[model samples]
Target: MCSSFRSLLPALRAFTAKCPPPQICTSLRTYATEAVPDFEHKPSHYGQPLFQSHPHLLRPHELTPGIPSEEYERRRKDLMDSLPSNSVVVLIAAPVKYMSGSIYKYRQGSDFWYLTGFEEPDSAVVLEKNASSRGYRMTLFSNGKDSAKEKWDGPRTGFDDALNFFKADDALTIKAFPAQLRSMISLYSNVYIDLPQSPRKNARSTKSLLRYLSPPVNPRSEYETVVESLSSSRRKPLAPHIAQLRAFKSVCEQQVMRMAADISGRSHAKTMRFTRPGISESALAAHFEYLCSLSGSQRLAYVPVVASGPNALIIHYTSNNQVVQDGEMILMDAGCEYNGYASDITRTYPANGSFTPPQRELYSAVLSAQKALVGLCTEAEGLSLHDLHRKSCDFLRRELKQIGFTLHTGDLERVLYPHFLSHPIGIDLHESSYSDRGESLKAGMVITVEPGIYVPPTAQFPKHFHNFGIRIEDEVLVGEKHPVVLSVSAPKEIADIEGACQGLLGLEPI
Candidate 1:
């Protein structure tokens, strides 16, 4: 307790004398509290539905319907893990399209939505990983909040809240995206992106952030331009990597796909019951779309093909304007999109509620082949799509021969079965279009099994069966032991289809 304590007492007394009093301190506290910005006042709406705003449509942790935020995070992590160190992944959002002055409905790009689940346009994401860190950093670039713009269009999840809302490491206004991307390209050793060429005509608004990045050019695409500007060897196509990941669906994705299939299948059944001899093909198509929308589907997956009589012989016949004759058959190929998933189904039935003798015979042959092929969509079968196609050709040839029509092996494939047997299905109607169909089927992979026989009026076939076309398509999910038919609700049996057309089965609205 000695000289040290005595020396500090004078300095402590001087410091206490200079400090503010209690009242002054209180005033200082009040001023500081008032100076801090208020962060609790959030916007009443956002570009997409949130659990807080739309509790009925979303759960607490879900980013999109049936897809949780954690899954999206995992997807990003998986992609980063696949790439080497010091690599960057760039993804762009889909731009809003306009037909004249009216705006068409907006849809996010499939690969972009698969990773971030952000449904807004004029946005982009950059994911970066360095050798020193085990994890990647996600930066989201979006529009900043503007009261004037928000008044005209709906609310936006501006850059200020994007970090927390989207679980991004950093967020900035989209205006800064170009500079940021250029900096990332210079710093990172590898760049993974997929930017297609933009069309010269029908350019987007000048104010759009994406339009600013990629202006309408003549021959080179946005990708080509980037490659020419930067080191082409350092850039890699990102789609094939993402496509491999999306090929096998998670459990939640499977559930969403099943719901999509159910909605579309039930709609097809309802359309069959509503069809009559005098109904126009266009009206039937509209009615089918109505049923799909009424039963929770967001929109049609693609343009529907509602063909009657000889029109069925033409593949991809979408001009549904013809009138149905009493004796002719109606072939409808349609599907619906639910949430982000899609479902495809096809059903051909008699317009007059009864098939002629030739119609039944041809339909039975195609139905038998389709049923057998669907069973092959299993891991245990160890068959690729090409294998199924060959098997289908054999089945059709035998069935046609049994039906009193002699067809050579080459004639069956060249003339009758023109299209491939199956294709992958998920987010887009033709999901992973670049994937090899020769690869063997794996569990959790969903695909379509379609078999059709189109007989034109020629000397090789009998007159009764001429001008008859029949097709049966269904969605199948490959399983470990057995295949699950997602579109089983749409009746395929001869008796069941006939019963549905005759109104014998008491079917309810989906």
Candidate 2:
């Protein structure tokens, strides 16, 4: 899809430059007609063309299956056991998103991925407690294979292979989901759905198709029927149960996460070594993600924040399009998702391969505070993010004072650090979002110990410190006694950072 679209881009630009908006659309349609004369553009269930015109959309699926079927069974059992007797749990996979002119590689819903490790999109899973003669079981509704659609979208693992590919007790076509729901809606007393994360009804198509079609008098959603069918039954959110199970990482999960962390760490190290003036923030991010992909990272864990200079003041700043100048610090908060596990590591280094006096002072402060808090990760049963977060705050307070920055707000005596010092990181970058078991930092749990001091141009700090942002983030694995730094391969010491940055130069832009 990307290659075909790229081929059309130059002509599309030419048409747009020479014509009005209406004419541009008309020319694109004509060009598309000529470009792919064989494309039938068969509409999907939602009326959009089902990616059939693209080559390699029919390519074989490639991935490292995250865990064995037994582990998936174990997870299902744990979740079912956590729920009340005779419960019904329904989880929907994330929909495949088409971004811009291309179909994005699908990312399965975290909850769905946790239970099945299935990567295909537009699939659904149902777990019923004591539904059959057996005590518990699972049924999968998958986008079963369609030879017609396979020409453009490639092969699919639908109903025919759902049982074999995803260890479901029974499998059915996703198109048959409504009928299945009708059959199973009243089977159990305790009904559950992952409603907290599912999409809302009446969602409009993004492609602007069907706007002229007459609207229905009373639009009904697939969920309304399920909810209205069970008037006398109790309904509950299944997220907490799933979250609880996901909180405690298994041996296999830890191994995947460690690999993810290591891959992400090496990407950061590469970014450090390649740092030089006149590089764009987008370039740095591309280089880092390229390194991650070179090391077998499947996709980015989240939108990377490659903020340089004052841009770092914006927490969650993902607009990595600015030019990195010499004598300025670069803050890169990025990670990659490897085999269903996620790694989030952020490192701040100098654009010129060296930090000035004020930059080093602030960077050292954040580094010290981060290390101090990481040492506190123990199996103390009751340790929560809140407790360690407070420790980070105190550490920041002292460090900021030593660094000659005045603290004023309740969070930092100022709002210099507008983000949390720590959070859980695993299958999701903020894996805690999917977890409801508890917030205790137990063994096998992976967390990030990130402490940073952002002195944007607006902050009332020393003049030299302005527009400089320094954040040292590392993935921390909760061990028997102390936290193990999984991302230690990314250097943090000032000498080490400088040494790593000064190693090479004149690399091609990503």
Question: Best candidate per lDDT, number?
Answer: 1
TM-score on alpha carbons, each prediction: 0.86, 0.79
What C-alpha lDDT values do all the predictions have? 0.80, 0.70
The whole-model C-alpha lDDT of candidate 1 against the native structure comes to 0.80
Which residue runs does candidate 2 get wrong by more than 4 Å? Answer: 1-66, 131-135, 158-160, 196-227, 230-233, 406-413, 434-439, 457-460, 504-510
lDDT of 2 by residue, 354-467 (tens): 878878888888888988888988776357777787788888889888867776665363567777777787788887655432456788777888878777565466777777
